[model samples]
Target: MPSFHHGAVEIAYLDEGEGEPIILIHGFASSKNVNWVYPGWMAELTKNGRRAIALDLRGHGDSGKLYDPAEYGIGTMAGDITALMDHLNIRRADMMGYSLGARITGWLAYRQPERLRSAIFGGLGIGLIKGGGPGENVATALDAPSLDDVTDPVGRTFRAFADQTRSDRKPLAACLRGSRELMTEQQAAAIRVPALIAVGSKDEIAGSADQLGKVIPGSQVLHIPNRDHMRAVGDKVYKTGVLEFLLRRP
Candidate 1:
C-alpha cells in the first residue's frame, strides 16, 4: 500500500522482499494485485532472494488518476518509473513489463540503459500500431464509452470490453492512450542490455513468437503454447522462462 509522488501524480506500488531489485509493471487495465500478485510472482521472486516491486501505473489502481491526455504520455509514465527508482535510492534494477507496461519499459531501456541490469517484456511488441500515438487517438478513445448503446458488431465488442473495464477503466484507457508512442524496430535495436521477450502462443496482439524473436538482438522469446496474453504470464512455462532469463548473469 506504499505510495510515492512521481512528479504531479502519485503512484501506488508494493515493495516486498530484499535483494537485487526487480520491478514489475502490469498491463493496461490491470493492477499490481490482479496482474502480478495474484499470480504469486511476488512470493516466487522473494523465495529466490530477489526483491519484488509491483507498481500500479499512474491513473491505475490506488494511484492518482489524471484525465488530461498529455499527462498520460508514455514518456511521463517512464519518467515515473525513473522517479520511483530515485526515490527508493535504487541505482540499478531489473525490470519486467507487460502490455502497456512493456512498451514503457522498452522506452526506459532505450533512454536509460545504464540504470538497468536486465529487462523482461511480455504481451506487446514493436511496430505494432493500434490506437494513434499520444494525444489525438487517446483523447478520442477516452471520450467513448465501453457501450455504444447499439446492438451492432461494434456495440458487441464494446460490451465485451466494458466487462473487462469494470475493474478500472480510467487507468486502463489512459494506458492505452499513453502507449500510442511506443518504439519502432529501429529504436528497439538500440537496446544493449540483456532482454527477454515473451508472449502467449495464441496472442494475436503480440504477433507470432518467431516475429518477436527476429527483432530483438540476442533476446530469447518464449511462446506459451495454447495460452494468450492473460494466461501466458501466469503459466508455469512463462514464469520459468522469465525467472531463468532474469537470474542468468550476462
Candidate 2:
C-alpha cells in the first residue's frame, strides 16, 4: 500500500522479498495482486532469493488515475517504472511484465536498457512489430455501461475483466486510447539486454513468439501449452521457464 510521487501522479507499489530485485508489471485491467501476487509469482521469486516489486500503472490499481488519454502514453508508463526505480535507489534489476505490461517492458528495453539486468515479457511477442493495437473497440468497451451493452468479443472480455477487477473505467479507457502503440521491428531488434519472451501457445493477443525470438537474437521463448492470455499469466510452465531463465542468467 506504500506510494510515491512520479511526476504529477502518485504511484502505489508493493516491495517484497530479498536479494537481486525484479520488478513485476501487470497487464491491462490487472492490479499487482491479480497479475503477480495471487499467482504466487512473488512467493516463487522470493523463494528463489530474489526481491520482488510490483506497481500499479497510472491508470490501474491504486495508482493515481488520469482521465485524459495523453497521460497514459507508452513512453509515460515506461517513465513511471524508471521513476519507481529512482525512488527506490535501485539502478538495475531484472524485470518482467505481462500483456500491456509486456508492451511497457518493450518500451523500457528500448528506452532504458541501462536500468535492466534482463527483461521477461509474458503474453506478448512479434505483434509489436506487425503494427496492431486495441483500437476504438477496446475504448468503447471500457466506456460501455455494462457487459450486455458491449458487442465486440475482445472488448467485451476486457470490459468484463475490468468490471471484475473494479478498475476505474475512465482512466482505463484513456489508457487504451493512449498506450496502444506496439513496438516496431527495428525497436525490437535494438534491445541489447538479455531477454526472454514467455507466452501461451493458444494466446491470440500476442503475436508469434518464435518470430519475436528470431528477431531479438539470443532471446529465449517459452510457449505454454493449452493456455491463453488470461490463463498464461498464472501458468506453472511460464513461471518455471522464467525462474530458470533468471537463475541461469543471474
In the predicted model 1, the residue pairs found to clash are none
- What C-alpha lDDT, on a 0 to 100 scale, does residue 29 get in candidate 2? 82
Worst 10 residues of 1 by lDDT: 127-136
Stretches off by above 4 angstroms in model 2 are none
Model 2, span 1-250: residue lDDT tens: 7999987899999999999999999998899999999999999999999999999999899999999988899998999999999999999999998988988888999888999999998988887677444668988999988889999999998999899988888899999888888787888999988999998999888888899999886799899999988999999999899989998884
Best by TM-score: 2
Name the lDDT of candidate 2: 0.89
Count clashing residue pairs in model 2: 0
Ten-residue region with minimum lDDT total, candidate 2: 126-135
Q: lDDT (CA) for every model shown?
A: 0.74, 0.89
What TM-scores do the predictions have?
0.87, 0.97
Tens digits of per-residue lDDT, candidate 1, 58-116, equal 87778888765578788888888989888889999999988777878888888899888
